[model samples]
Target: MMGEDADMRTMLAPPMSTPHDAGRRDLEQRYQRVCDLFPDQRVEIVNGRIVIREVPTLDHNRMIFRLLLQIMAFADQRGWTACNDIKLFLGTQVDRYRPDITVVPAEPRMWDAENVYADQTLLVVEVVSPSSRDDDNLLKPHSCSLAGVPLYLVIDPLEKTARLLSQPGRSGYVQQDAVMLGELLLLPDPWDLKLDTGKFLN
Candidate 1:
């Protein structure tokens, strides 16, 4: 039995590092350097490209703050944390995201280092800006759905609407609900909360 265990351990040991491994590590270090150089902007890897997002406008910040205030109390009651601009690891192929707002379990077990797995998040909210309209409206929903995120909310100031996507699956969200700004948005099961969007119109 001891001999068998030793053999198994040897088999499971990490393989010898290759040139590819060194290259990957060097890329990671370079990415970290870029992030350090631009601490004020959002730097991400998307589709194997390094993208830097400019800081948001005041109106955008205010809108997120309004939504955050509403979600904070509810999340607190449910042992979830509501945060803005946190790193979210989307998938294995060099994709990272910083959702405008994210609701996640407060427990450390749900987190992965400094990044949160999309499948473990309770909700992800994206407030659209001119530069990110396509990504926020189309690409994000698809990625989040594939990652099994339960809920995704899109607030579009340009459209003056809010959309809630639910029932994530291999294909995408099976259900979607939308309302104009200033209307009440219903968050379904597991949330069962009503969001008052009256103040969002400012």
Candidate 2:
């Protein structure tokens, strides 16, 4: 038999959470530990804390569906792939963020084997909720900018508006356009995609 330390190492080798390590693990360890625990749930690591929110509302999922269709079509045209509900890890420099949708390269990388890295992230779309307003707006823009994510689109159905930010830099995106419902947002090249908001208005 191995020593107690070696036994502990072998026990926690896989990412299945146990009752013992529930309360005192660090942020990074906690994040990895919950990977498979909530396989069918929406779990996120926010500000060094693990958060589990209620299942998204129908309207939320509907908005996500509409935007996802657009992104998928756009990516298909460019021969790229769009994944929904993927966690975009920005390394230790920035915390993790689970966007409603993320557009990435066709090929996978080591970093993306589990969580998709921000460097591989081309575009991210977030459908805002009342509970997540600050996160979807303030926190995400700051982190995505710091991580060099090219485009960050925030859609707020409650506000009947959308905010598009680009040109990520240390301070944040240099350009920002606040688009009202029904107004078209033409994403910059190389995607050059146009987002329609008519349905979101009605």
Alpha carbon lDDT of residue 90, candidate 1? Answer: 71
Question: For model 1, how does the per-residue alpha-carbon lDDT over 1-202 read when each residue is reduced to its tens digit?
Answer: 9999999999999999888678667766777788899987888765445678878889989999999888888889988888786887776544677888888887633346668888888889998999889888988788889888899999999999999999999898999999999999998877888998776778
Q: Which stretches of candidate 2 lie over 4 Å from their true place?
A: 1-25, 108-112
- Give me the runs in candidate 1 sitting further than 4 Å from their true place: 1-30, 108-111
Clash count of each predicted structure: 0, 0
Model 1: weakest 10-residue lDDT segment is: 106-115
TM-score of each: 0.83, 0.82
Give candidates' CA RMSD values in order. Answer: 3.8, 7.6
Best prediction by lDDT: 1
Each prediction's whole-model lDDT (CA): 0.83, 0.79
